[model samples]
Target: MFRRLEEGDPAVRTLWSQLVEISLQEMFGIFDRLGGVTLDYPKDGEAFYQPYLGEVIAEAKEQGVARQSDGALIIEVPGEETPLLLLKSNGTTTYATRDLAQVRYRAQTFHPAKILYCVANEQALHFRQYHAAARRLGFVPDSLELVHVKFGLMRGAEGKLSTRRGTSIFLQDVMDEAVRRAREVVEAKNPELSDREKTEIAEVVGIGALKYFDLSHDRRHDIVFDWDRMLSLKGDSAPYLQYSYVRAVQILAKVGTVNFPLDKWKGESGRFGVGLPEDVQRLVRELARFPLVLERAAADYTPHTIAQYLNDLAGQFSQFYECYPVLKAEGEDRAIRLAIVAGVANVLRRGLDLLGIKVLERM
Candidate 1:
């Protein structure tokens, strides 16, 4: 005889909970090590909404939005030829049923003004139908904003990474490989450092590279997983930005503590009156644009905007560093240049942090 699946079934429930816990722990551990901000998983919607499925179906039917078609409960969605199936002939609820229930539950529980769903581009139609059905059934308010943030596929050199095709790369393996490769580079460049320092630097650089590569691209564009491009110090990669930050830190260290006179530098044009060099002026202008860039990134839901800004800022700083003298300069010129360096370092740190990439003091 078959047994009913219930929470009281200790044998199945305990094992399933343990499995989910273990997987979440592993994923969170890797993310934490990579300097990513921690996030809590939402409550188990599947279990919480199962009992209320009948109620949702009944409501849909009462509202004349859902009807039986070919042994399935379907809701006719606008602008679509096919109706959204809520329940199959076998009495099993579909994903639409769960999602509709989730929308209602969230609306009642949180009363959020907007909800964003980040899923693959392939699920565009499904979400459109789901949102339409939710609105038609009065589960979601007409004013409630629903955004679908669709991202493209991440493919390997062979093609799209798939578990069934045996081309999938595990997160742990990717992290380990990144660290291993980074360690090799670190040992070659900074062999004089202690083993511990090398290991720490490797971890920072490796994880930063991975994050930078992912965040530096437009989400809708498909990306190829490339190691050389990601780990390189010469291009618009994490190492390049880290190197720039380290250079700025080194300059600040040599110049001692800088006390920039805010009132003296203030002017009607917002430009410093310290007779700043053109390159220094350029760097300052770029630094000032950080806030606007961050705003745009948030509005667009694009981390790549920040990535591009950091890359440009780093490039400008590089130019300024090569063109000017910070340590040996005297009086106002030195102070102004040092202040610019400090600003660049601060902006770089903040930008990289927003992108979930770690910065290194010395690299």
Candidate 2:
């Protein structure tokens, strides 16, 4: 639901609006996700919060985003207001309070053992407060964990995502740009490819590259957006992975065989009998590492690790492609090399999927 809101879906807007008189603090509860800007609390005493009703109000007033003096917390999160609701007289209830209520409800209703909040790094303190409040409210206590899986903001070439000037770039726009850039590269590289082929390929390569770039960096560190870096055809980019996959498919197509004794090859005594190309063995080892890579990335809520893993796998497969001749080889050796390439292709496809990028069957 929060993701839907972030995406600006009208349905999510309607759903959030249907809530009872909501407070400034309650927005977080209904938001389901946090990011970018946040409310600020006082530095010292309660009097500082007194003027704002509570610390939540003080933060909103300081930020000049909202204030609530009526309704439940009086802000009514769903409705429209000039300058928005920043504070209310309740002194105890606010957006944060509402967030606690929602959290409590979720904890009791769903009884999820754990909750992962995907939010921006800038809102670390806000999320921390949310979790702390949940604990204080005896919502989930210590058993049901609440995690703020935060990531840095996405900036355009200009620096920082702007909302006031109507300069904030939507995620959809970013995705579209990536696809457009990728399509250009594809046309430039292969003039013979049809428009449909180029378009489909571009969608995968372009989106994959951008997603990889975003995931390649540590989530805590801010990323400076670069069109060249995110859309490059060469180096460690999405096209590179796509190219590797294309090459693998081409090799298999040319070889004209998919039959491999995969089960037997692993356990057969002949496994050690044949000298598999060093490069093939290395590629196979890399392919086998995908599950571990994905597991770690998902556990940490860091997609960059997955991107890095995909990049490394692609590089290894490319090297294997260059060093060995799958079509030229024969017997168990050929079978083994083809198997390695097949494994690489599968892992690459799956890894890209996890990053929310498409995988093209051909370049």
Candidate 3:
């Protein structure tokens, strides 16, 4: 699964994916050197490295540092013919041996500013030892940035998702289930609505709920999946933000002819400033912080930061909408307030979208 992520567009989900790929590649090399796995994976505890691992062993041999014997690939250590076995005396390769090859390849080729190995928290010791082996082999750089990004696991109510027991809840399944539940809720709330309308609304509510639930927590913390919490119409769930967007839309429907003027607002400073009441002042502040929030999220690789920002923005807009009357206000204040609300609604929805959440125009 981790290896599959390396070949995708960069996203929050892919960061950990590449890290796991690198780690597993190294482990495969080590396993190859040891006696290869005789047991099957996840059953008898037998593990084997990914295929095409011979390339690394072949490269080592060409460099006059390794030899192949009895179907095993071995590399010379500092003092002895005691080869770092890459493959088992049997034909199979091991996880550790494959990983050794991966490290060797990266040091020689990638030369990255940093090679971050994102793994689970428990593998810290394994990473340290892996780096130590590299240093000993005179293949690793002292100045190379070798980082391990670790995190806790997500658990369901039953327990940690277990593929072994066929109990692991897939991400796709979670998304679909959320949508199904949202549809149910919408049907209950608005029985007069058509099925098509309910489905459209449910798509936004469901996807929003899933993304918000996953991102609201810090990555270092283990998450326990709760259907009720994730699908809640209140609290910090996606549905709350969606409902907030819906409220903004309702207000806009009441006030006609609101223009965004995004292009005009750009490259000019202080010219577009409009007077705002205290209630709307808070909303404007939240809207203006959109770019800053996005920058922070991208810089820290934290999607949750963006999620939290949108939630706060939504709350602020909800308050402003309730307290101020956009359509009933006199003179320019009405137009300005409408514009501000519309702009804020756009920003909030966009931010939520980046987090893979959806926005609903109506509850």
Q: Which candidate leads in TM-score?
A: 1
After aligning candidate 2 to the native by TM-score, how far in Å is the CA of 14 from where it should be?
9.8
The predicted structure with the larger TM-score, 1 or 2, is 1
lDDT of 3: 0.68
As a whole number from 0 to 100, the lDDT of residue 2 in candidate 1 is 10
lDDT of 2 by residue, 193-290 (tens): 98888887777677677667887788988888888977765657777777777777777777675653444434344242134555555565566567
Candidate 1 per-residue lDDT, tens place, 1-363, comes to 012233246777677678778877887787678765667546453667867777889999998999999898999998999889998887777788888988898898889999999998988989999999999989988878999998988899878999999889987889899989999989998999999999999999998998899889999888999999989988699989999999999888876776544446556877743356566666777777789999999998999999999999999888888888888889867778888888888899999999888888887
Every model's TM-score: 0.92, 0.70, 0.66
Q: Rank the candidates by TM-score, best first.
A: 1, 2, 3
lDDT of candidates 1 onward, in order = 0.85, 0.65, 0.68
- List ranges where model 3 is wrong by over 4 Å: 1-52, 58-91, 95-119, 122-149, 164-167, 253-275
lDDT of 2: 0.65
Q: Quick one: best lDDT, which candidate?
A: 1
Cα lDDT for residue 142, model 2? 84
Worst 10 residues of 2 by lDDT: 78-87
